[model samples]
Target chain A: MAWVWFHRFGSPPHFYRLATRLTPWFAWPAALLCLAGLIGGLVLAPPDYQQGDGFRIIYVHAPAAWLSLMVYVVMATSAAVGLIWRMTVAYAVSASCAVIGASFTALALATGMLWGRPMWGTYWEWDPRLTSELLLLFLYLGYLGLRNSIDDVGRADRASAVLAIVGVVNVPIIHYSVIWWNSLHQAPSVMKFGRPTMPAAMLVPLLLMLAGFTAYFVALLLIRARGELLRRERNAHWTAEAAGATATG
Target chain B: MSEQRVGFAAAAAALIARDLRLALRRSGDTLQPLGFFLVVTALFPLALDPQLSLLRDIAPAALWVGALLSSLLALDLLFREDAQDGTLEQLALCGLPFQGLLLAKTAVHWLLTGLPLVLIAPLAATALGAPYEAMPGILAAVLLGTLALSLIGAVGAGLTMSLKRNGSLLALLVLPLAAPVLIFGARATALAIAGEPLAAPLYLLAAFTVLSATLAPWALAAAVRIGLE
Candidate 1:
C-alpha cells in the first residue's frame, strides 16, 4: 500500500499536483517568518559588545550559508535517488536545486564580504569557510553548466547526477582540509563557528532566519519542480490534460 | 561468465600498454603539456620582479599552478581519441570490467601527462628560485599531487568526453574538485621551503591521492558509460 503511494507520488503529474497544493503551505509561513526574523534580528537583537551592530549581518549571512550547504545536500540526495530509482520527479527536484543553492551561496559570500570589510579591514580573506564556500559556488556552476550544455534532458540528468554524487563525497574533505590548511597560516578569526559562544539573544534570531530560509527553499523548490515536470513530461497524456485544464479553466 | 575471457589483470595491462604505446607514437600529446608547463612557469619570472626572495616565496604555488594547468591541458586527450574512434564502446562491451579499464586508462594518463610534470617540477622550482632544501619535499608532493590530479582528471575527462569542444568546460569541472591537491601540494612544498615539518601536509597529500585513486575510477567508469550511451 505504501509502495503504491510512493510510486504515485513519484509520478510527474501526481507530484506536480502535490507541489501545487503544498507550495502555499510553505511559501506564506516562510515569507512571514522571514519578515519577523529580519525585523527582530536587525532592530531588536542586542548589538554585540565586541563587534557592535556590524555583527547583525550574521542574521542574513549565517542563514544563507546554512541554506547553501543544506541545499547542496538536498540536491545531491535527490540526484542519488533519481539515479537509483530512475525517478524523473527526483531529477526535476535536483535540477531545480542548483540555481537556488547558487543564489544562497552568492548571498553568503556577499554578506560575508560585507561583514569582513568592517571587522577584518579587508573585503575578503582566504579564510577556510569563505574559500570553501567559494569553491561550493564553483561546484554549483559546474553542475548547472553540465546540465545546460546537454540537449537531452535524460542524459543531462544522468551525467549531472554523477557529478553531484562525486561532489557530495568531496564536500566534507574540502571543508576539513581547508580548515586544516587555514589553521597553519592564521589564527582563528571572528567568523568561525558560533554555536557554543553566541548569546541566546543573537542565536535565537539566527535560528529563526535559518528555519525561514529553509522553508523558503522548500517553497521555491516545489514551484521550480512543477515547471520542470511540466516541460519534461509535456508529451505525457496527463500533462497535456493538465495544461488544457489550466488553459480553459 | 565465459571461459575464453581474458583475466582482469592481463586485460588491464593490455589497455595500459596500448594507451602508452599510442601516446608514445604521437609523442606530441605527451610533450606538449610538458612544454606548456615549462613556458607557463618561465613566464612568471618575466611577469613578476626578478627578486630571488620574492620568486622563492612564490615558487611552490607558481609551480603547482603550472602543473595544474598543464595537467588540465592534457586531460581532454584522455578519452577523446578512444571516444571518437568508438574504441570506448568496444572496450565497454569487452569482457573486462569497466572500472579496471578506466583504472588502466587513468594510470596511463598519469604516466604520460602527470609523470613528466612531476619529473620537471624541480626544474621549474629551480628556475623560480625555490630553495635547494625544498627540492625533495617539492618532488614528493608533486609526484603524489599529479597522480591525484590524473585520477581525478579521468572522471572529468569522462564526463566531458561526449562534448565536441570541452577544453575550458573540462577545466571548469575539474579545477574546483582538484582544489585539495593544489592546496596540500603547494603547502607541503612551502613548508619544506620554510624548513618546517613536512609530515602533516605530505601525509594529507598522500591520503588525498590514495582516496582519489580508490574512488575516482568507479565514477570515471560511470561517466564514461553515460557518455557512451
Candidate 2:
C-alpha cells in the first residue's frame, strides 16, 4: 500500500503537480525565516568579545557550509534511489541539487575567506574544514561537468549517479586524511569556533538561519525539479495537460 | 565448489594475462606516463628556486603530484581501449562476476603504470634531495598510494569510457576523488624526509588502499555497464 504511494510519487506527472503545489509552502516560510534570521543575527545577537563584528559572518558562512554538505548528501541519496529504482523524478531531484549545492559551497568558501582575513590575518588557511570544503566544491563541479558532457540523458543520469555515490563514499575518507595532514603541519594558531556554551541569543539566530537555509534549498529544489521533470518528460502525453493546467490554474 | 573457485581464479588470471600482453605490445604507451612523471618532477625545480633545502622541503608534494598527474595520463587505457574494441561488452556478457573482471583489469593497470611509478619514486625523491634513509618510506608510500590511485582511477576511466573528449573531464572527475591519496601519500613522504616515524601515514595509506580495493571495482563495474549501455 505504501509502495503504491511511492510509485505514484515517482511518476512524472504526479511529481510535477506535487512540486508545483508544494513550492509555495516552502518558499514563503523560507523567505520569512531568512528575513527573521538575518535581522535577529545581525541586529539582535550580541557581538563576540574577541572578534566583534567580524564574527557575524558566521551567520552566513556556517549555514552555507552546512547546506553545502547537506545538499551533497541529498543529491547522493536521490541519485542512489534513482539508480536502484530507475525513478526519473529521483534523478531530476539529484540533478536540481548539484548547481544549488555548488553555489552554496562557493558562498561558504568566499565568506570563510572574508572571515579569515581579519581573524587569521590571511585570506586562506590550510585548515582541514576549509580544505575539505574546497574539495567538496570541486566534487560538485565534477558531477555537473560529467552530467553536461554526456549527450544521452539516460547515460548521463546513470553515470553521474555512479560518480555521486562514489563521491559520497570518499568524502569521509577525504575529510579524515585532510585532518591528518593538518595535524602533521600543525598551524601556528587555531581558530576556535563557538564557545563551549554559546549564549542563547546568538545560538537562536544561527539555528533559525540553518533552518531557513534548509527550507530555501527545498523550495529551490522543488522549483528546479519541476522544470527538470518537464525537460525529461517533453514527449510524455501528460505534460500537455500539466502545462495547460499550470497556465490556467 | 572447489572446482568453481579454481575456475574463477583461472578466469581472473586469464583476464590479467590478456591486459598485461596488451600493455607489453604497446610498450611506449605504457612508458609514456612515466616519462611524463619524470618531466613533471623535473619542471618543478626549474619553475621554482632549485635550492637543495627548498627542494627537500617540497619533494614529497612534488613526487606525489607528479604520480597523480601521470597516473591520470594513463587512466584512459584502463577501459577505453577495451571499450573501443568491444572487449568490454564481451566481458560484461561473459557470465562471470563483472566486479572481479574489473578488479583484474585494475590490477593490470597497477602493474604497468603504478608499480613503475613506485620503483621510480625513490630515484625522483633522491634527485630532489630527499634523504637516503627516506628511500624505503618513499618506496612504500608510492607503492600503496599508486595502487589506491589505480583502483580509484579505474572507476573514473570506466565513467568516461564512452565520451569522445574525456582527457580533461577524466582528470576533473578523478582528481577530487583521489585527493585523500595525495594527502596521505605526501604526508608519509614528508614524515620520512623529516626523520619522523612513518608508521601512521603509511598505515592510513594502506587502509585507504584496502578500502579502495574492496569498493572501487564494484563502482567501476557499475560505471562500465552504464557506459556500455
Candidate 3:
C-alpha cells in the first residue's frame, strides 16, 4: 500500500493533477492570513518603545528572510530527492523553486536595506547575516544560470542538482566565515534579530505572517511545478487528455 | 595487499605525470595565471594610494583576492581539454575508481597553478607593502587556501565540463563556495602582518582544507558521471 502511494506521488501526471487540485486550498488561506496579519501587525500592534512604527517592517522583512532560507533548503532537498530517486516530479519541484527562492532573497535584502537606512543611517552594511543573505542570492543565481545554460532537461536537472547540493552544504560554512571575518574587522555593530522578547501584539501577527507566507509559497510552487511537469512531460498521453479536458470544459 | 597499494599509487602517479607533461607542453597556459596574479597586484597600487601605510593595510585582502581570481583563470580549462578530447571519458570507462582519477587531476591543477601561487605570494605581498614577517603566514595560508580552491574548482570544472562556454558560469558556481577560504586566508595574513597570534584562522583554514579534501572527490566524481551522462 505504501509503495503504491509512493509511486503515485512520484508520477508526474498524477502529481500535476494533484498540484492543480491543491493550489486553491493553499492560495485562499494564504490571502486571508496575509491580510489579517498585515492589519494586526500594522494597525493593532503597539509601536515599539525603541524603533516605534518602523518596527512594523519586520512583518514583511522577517517573513521574506525566513522564506529565503526556507526555500533554498526545500530546493536542495527536492534536488537531492530527484537525484537519488530519479523522479521527474521532484526535479520539477526543484526547478520551480529557484526563481521564487531568488525573489524572496532579493525581497529580504531590499526590505532589510529599507529598514537599515533609517535605523543604521545607511542602506547597506557588511553585517554577517546580510552578507550571508547576499551570498545566498548569488548561489540561487548560479543554480538558475546553470539550469538555463544546459539545453537538455535531464542533463540540466542532474547538473543543477549537483550545484544545489554543493551550495546547501556550503551555506553554513559561508555564514560562519562572514561572522568570523566581521568580528576580526571589528566594524560597527548592526542590529540582529536577537530580540529577547516580543509582546503578544507584535509576536502573533509575525507568526501569522510566517504561516501565511509559507502557504503562499506552496500555492506558487504547486502552480509552477504543474507547469514544469506539463513542459517536461509534453509527450505523455495524460498531458494531451488534460489539455483536451480543459479545452472542452 | 602491499602490492595492490603500490599499484594504486603508481596509477595515480602516472596520471599526475601525464597531466604535468601536457601542462608543460602548453607552457604559456601554465604561466598565464601567475602573470595575471602579478598584474592584478600591480593594478592595486596604480589605482589606489601609493602610500606604503595604506597599501600595507589593504595588502592582505588585495593579495587574497588576487590569488582567488588567478586560481579561477586556470579552472575552466581543468576538465575541458580532456573532456573534449575524449580522455576524460576513457578514464571514466577504464574500470579504475573514477574518484581517484579526479583527485589526481585536481592534484595536477594544484601543482601547476596552486603551488606557484603560494611560492609567489610573498612577492605579491611585499609589492603591496606587507611586511617581511608576514611571508611565512602568507605562504601557509595560500598553500592551504589554494589546495582547497583546486579541490573546490574540480567540482565546478566537472559540473560544467559539458557546457561549451562555461567560463563565467564556472566562477559563479565556485565563488560563493570559496568564501570561507578567502575569509580565513585573508584574516591569517592580516594577523601575520600585525604580529598577532594567527593560530585560530590557520586552524580554521586547515579544518576547511581537510574537510574539502575528504568530501570533494566524491562530489567531483559524481559530477563527472552526471556530466558524461
Candidate 4:
C-alpha cells in the first residue's frame, strides 16, 4: 500500500492530496532535526580545537552544499526520467527541483564565502570549488531562462531536458575541478570514507544537520512539485478543485 | 562487404562542399555573421585603449571571445531558415540522415566564420601587438574551438528556433557550456604569449572539439525531430 501510494504520486491530484496530508509528517521532523542540530552545532559542540567557533559554519554550509549538488542530481535524473518516459509529471518535478537546487547552491556559496573571508583570507578566489559552484548557479539560471523563453511547455521540457543532461557533465567536472585545475579550496574532509577530519562531537552534529537538510529538501520538493502539477494540470477536474481550495484558503 | 564505411575525412569534405555551394548562391545569408564578428572585434579597441602592450595582452582573449559570440550570433541562422520555410521538414522526410545535414551546415558555418577568423586573426593579433609566437596557438585554438562552438550552438539553435527571440536565448544556452572551451583557448594563447608550453591545453582544446563534433549533431537532430513532432 505504501508503494502503491508512492506510485500514485505521479498523479497530480493524488500527489497534491497526499502532499497536503503528509506535509506535516516531513515538516515536524525537519524542524525538530534542524532545531536540535543547530543547537548542538552552535552551543553544545566544542569549538574547533584550532579555528575555534569559525568552523561551526560547516554545520549549515556543508549540508547546504551537499544539497546543492544532490538537488541537481535529483533534477537531472528526473529530467532524464521525464524525457525517457515522456512523463509530464516527471518534468514538473524536475523543474521544481531546479529552483530549489539553485537557491540551495547560492546559500552554500554565500556561507562558504563568509567562512572563506576570515579563514582563507579572501572573500572571493577563483578556486575551482568556488568557481564550479558559481558555474552550477549559471547553469540553473540558464535552464530557467531557456524554460521561460519557450512559451510552449512541451518544447520547453524537451529543450530543458537536453540542457539538463548536457549540463550534468559539469557535475563531474565541478566535483573534480579542484583536482584538475588546482585551487585553494581543500577537498571534502568530512564525507571521506575512512574517517572524518573533525572529532566525533563535530561530526555527529554535522551529520544531523545534513539529515535535517535532506528532510527539508524532500518537504520543499514535494510542495513545489504539487504546485507545478496543479499549474500544468489545471485543465483537469482535480486541478480545478485543488486550485479552488488553495485560492480560498 | 557490399559498401565501405565513409571516412570522416571524406564525409567532412562532402559536407563542407555542400554548405559552401549552398551559401555561395545565397551569399547574403553568410555576411551577417562576418559583419557582426568584425564589428564586435572592432568594439574592444575603441571602448578600451589602443596601446600596444594593453592590446597585446587582451588581444587573444578578445579575438577568441568575439569569434565565439559571432559564431553563436550566427547560430540562430543555422536552423531558422530551414525551420521557417519547412526545409527542415523536407530534410526530415528525405532519406539522407538529418544529423548529416546538421553536421554539413555546421561544417559550412565553421568554414565561413571560423576560417575567416583565423585568417583575420593575424592582422588583429598585430593590431593588439600579440607576439608572433602567439599567432599559431591563437589560430589553432580559435579554429578548433569555433568549430565546437558552432557544433554546440547548432544544438541550442535547433532547440530554440521554435521559440520567439531565440537569439538571446540561444546565447544563454550555449555560452555557459562554452566556458571551458573559451577558458582553455584563452589560457593556451596567453601561455604562448608569455613563452610557455601550450601542448597540454591545446590537447584539451582538441579533445573538446572532437567531443562536440561527435555528439552535438545527434542532439540537434533529436531536438529538431521533437520540435517537428
Candidate 5:
C-alpha cells in the first residue's frame, strides 16, 4: 500500500490523472506566492546601503540564477531516472525541464546585464560568473539541439541524457572558477560556507523569493510535462482513455 | 585472426592502419580542415590588434580555438562515409568491437587531420610571434587535445551519421560538447609558458583525454548501435 504511490505515479494513466488533480493546487499557490513575493520584495526589502535602488534587481536576478542551476539538476536527475528505469515519463519531465531552465538562464543573463549597466557601469564583463552563466545557456541549447537533431525519441533521450550528465560537471566548475581563478566576479558572499553575511532583515525576503521562484518553477514544469506527456503518449490507448475521462470529469 | 594469434594491440594497429590508408586515398578531405584552420587563424590577427606583444599574449587561446573550430570542420566524415556506403554495416558485422573501431578512427584522424595541424602550427605560432617557450606547450596541448576531440566527435558523428544534413548538424552537436577541451588546452599552454606550474592543467587535460578515450568509444558504439536499430 505504501509503495502504491510509486506504482500509480509510474503508470501514464495514473500520472495523467494525478497531474490533473495536482494542477490547480500547484497553480493557485504558485500564483499567490509569486504575487506576494513580488510585492513584498519590491516594497518591503530594504535597499542595499551600497547600491541603493539599483540593487533591487536582486529580487529577480538571484532567483533566476538559482533556478538556472536548480532546473539543470532536476533535469539531470530526471535523465538519470530515465536511463536507469527506462521510463518515458522521466524523459518528458526532463524535456520540460530543458525548456524552463533555458528560459530562466536567459532571464538571469538579461537581468544581470541590466543590473550591470547600473552597478558595474558596463553591460558586459568577461567576468567568470557572467561567462559561465552565458555558457550555461549554451549548454541548455546544446541539450535541446541534441534532442532535435535526433529523430528517434528514445535515442534523443539517451543522447541528451549523456550530455546533461556531462554538462553538470561544468556547474561546479563555473561557480568555483571565479573564486579559484582571477575572475572579475565577486566571491561568494552571504551564501558562503559560514553564516549568512547579511542580517535576517535582508535574508527573509531573499528566502521568500527563493520559495516563490521554486513554486513557480514547479507549476510551470508540471504544465509543460503534461503537454509533452500528452504528445509523446498520443498513440497509446492510455492517452485516449485519459482524454475520455477528462472530457467526462 | 585466431583467438590465440591476434591480440588487442595488433588488432587496433591493423584497424588504425586500414582507416589511415582509406583517409589518405582521397585525402583532399583532410586538407579542408587545414585550410579552415589557416583561414580562421588569419581572421584573428586581422580582427585584433596585431601588435607583436598583443599577438603573443592571445596566441595560445587563438591557437587552441582555431584547432577546435578546424578539427570539427571535418567531423561529419567520422562515420558518414562509412555509414552511407554500407561500410559501416560491414564494420558492425566485423568481429571487432565498436570501441576498437572507434579507437582506430581516432588514430587515423590524428594522422590525417590532427597531424597536419601540428605540422602547420609551428609556422602559425611563429607568424603570431608567440614566445619561443610557448611553442612546445602549444604543439603538445593541441596534439593531445585534438586526439580527444576526434574521439568525442566520433561519438556524435556516429549518432548523427545516418541523419540527413549531417554536416551542419554535426558542428552544432560536437562543438559545444568540446568546450572544456578548448578552455583547458588553451589555459594549459598559456600557464606553462608563463613559468607557472605545468602539472595542474596538464593533468586536467590528460584526465579529460583519458576519460574521453576510456568512455567515449563505448558511448559511440552504443550510439551507432542505436542508430542502426
Candidate 6:
C-alpha cells in the first residue's frame, strides 16, 4: 500500500499537482509567521545585557544559517533518493534545493559578518562556523556548476547526485575539523553554540523565525520543483493536459 | 569466486603498472607538475619579502598550497587520455571490478604526482628557510595528505572526464572538499616547524586518508560510469 503511494508520489505529473496544491498551504503561513517573528524579534525582544541590540541580528542570521544547512541536507537526501530509486521528482526537488541553499548560505555569511563588526570589532574572523558556512556556499556552487555544465539532464542528475552524496558525508567532517582548527588557533569569535542559555523573550522570537524560515523553504521548494517538473515533462500528455486545463481555468 | 577475485587483483595490478609506465614514458606529465610546484614555491620569496624569518613562518602553508595546486594540475589528465582513446570503455567492459581499477589508477596517479611532491616538499621548505627539524613532520603530512588528495581528485577527474574545459572545473569541484586536508597538513607542518608535538593533526590527516581511500574509489567508479554513459 505504501509502495503504491510512493510510486504515485514519485510520478512527475502527480508530484506536480501535489506541489501546486501544497504551495499555498506553506506560503501563507510562512508569510504571516515571518512578519510576526520579525516584529517580535526586532521590536519586542529584550536587548542582551552585554551585546545590546546588535545581537538581534540573530533572529535573521540564526534562521538563515539553520535553513542553509537544512536545505543542503534536503538536497543531498533527495539526490540520494533519486540515485537509489531513479525518481525524477526527487531529482527535481534536489535541483531546486541547490539555489535556495546557496542563497541562505550567502545570507547567513552576510548577516554573520554584519553581526561580527560591532561585537567582535572585526567583520571577519577565521571562526569555525563562519569558515564552514563559507565552505558550504562553495559546495552549493560546485553542485550547481556541475549540474549546469552537463548537457543531458539525466547525466547531470546522476553526476551531481554523486557529488552531493560525497559532500553530505564530508559536511560533518568539515565542520568538526574547522572547529578543531579554530580551537588550535584560539581566536575569540562572536558565534558559539556552547550553551542554550537564552532568555525566554529572546528564545521565543528566534524559534518563531526558525519555523517561519523552514516553512518558507518548503513553500519555495515546492514552487520551484513544480516548475522544474513541468518544464522537464512539457511534452508528456499529462503535462500538456494539465497546462491546457490551467490555461482554460 | 576466489579464482575470479585473484584475476581481478591481477588485472588491477596490470592497470596500475600500465598507467605508471605511461606516466614514466611521458616523463613530462610527471615532471611538469613538480616543476610547477617548484616554480610556485620559488615565486613566493620573490613576490613576498625575502626575509628568512618571514619566509620560514609562511613556508609550511606555502609549500602545502603549492603541492595542492600542482597536484590539481595533473588530476585533469588522470583519466583524460584513457577516456579519449576509449580505454575507459574497454576497462568498463572488462570483467575486472571497476572500483579496484579506479583505486589502482588513483594510486598510480598519487605515485607519479603526489609522491614527487612529497619528496621535494622538504627542499621547497628549506629553500623558503623553514626549519630543518620540521622536515619529518612535513614529510609525513605531505605523504598522507597527497594520497588523500589523489583519492579525492580521482572523483573530480572522473566527473569531469567528458568535459573539454575541465581544468578549472576540476579544481573547483575538488578544492573545497580537500580543505580539511590542507588545514591538517599545514598545521602539522607548522607545529613541527615550531618544534611542537604533531600527533593530533597527523592523526587527523591519517584518518582523512583512510576515509578517502575507503570511500572515493566507489564514487570515482560511479562518476566514470556516468561519464562513459
From the highest DockQ down, the ranking of the candidates is 2, 3, 1, 6, 4, 5
TM-score pick, better of 4 and 6? 6
Misplaced by over 4 Å in model 3 are A187-190, A245-249, B1-6
| Model 3 agreement with the true structure over A1-249: per-residue lDDT tens digits | 769988999998889889989999999999999999999999999998888898899999999999999999999999999999999999999999999999999999999999998889999988887899999999998998899889998889998888888888899899989988888677756565636688888888998999999999999999999888888896898997756556554
lDDT of 4 at A120: 66
What are the clash counts of all predictions, listed in order? 0, 0, 0, 0, 0, 0
Task: Score residue A69 of candidate 6 by CA lDDT.
Answer: 95
True contacts kept of 6: 0.57
Could you tell me which residue pairs clash in candidate 6? none
Candidate 3: residue pairs that collide: none
DockQ-derived CAPRI band for the predicted complex in model 4? acceptable
> Of models 2 and 4, which has the larger lDDT?
2
Give the better candidate number (3 or 6) by lDDT. Answer: 3
lDDT of 6 by residue, B14-68 (tens): 8988988888898976799999999999998998899998987888778889988
Question: What is the C-alpha lDDT profile of model 4 across A129-218, one tens digit per residue?
Answer: 677788888888888888888776777788788878777865674345334444323554321221446777788888888898999898
Point out where model 5 deviates above 4 Å. A1-7, A174-195, A245-249, B1-10, B89-96, B192-197
lDDT of 2 by residue, B128-220 (tens): 999899999999999999999999999999999889976588999999989988988998899899899999889989999999988998899
Error of 4 at A63 (Å): 2.4
lDDT computed for candidate 4:
0.77
- Minimal lDDT window, size 10, model 5 chain B: B165-174
Give the fraction of reference interface contacts each candidate recovers.
0.59, 0.86, 0.84, 0.41, 0.20, 0.57
Q: Whole-model lDDT for model 3 versus the true structure?
A: 0.90
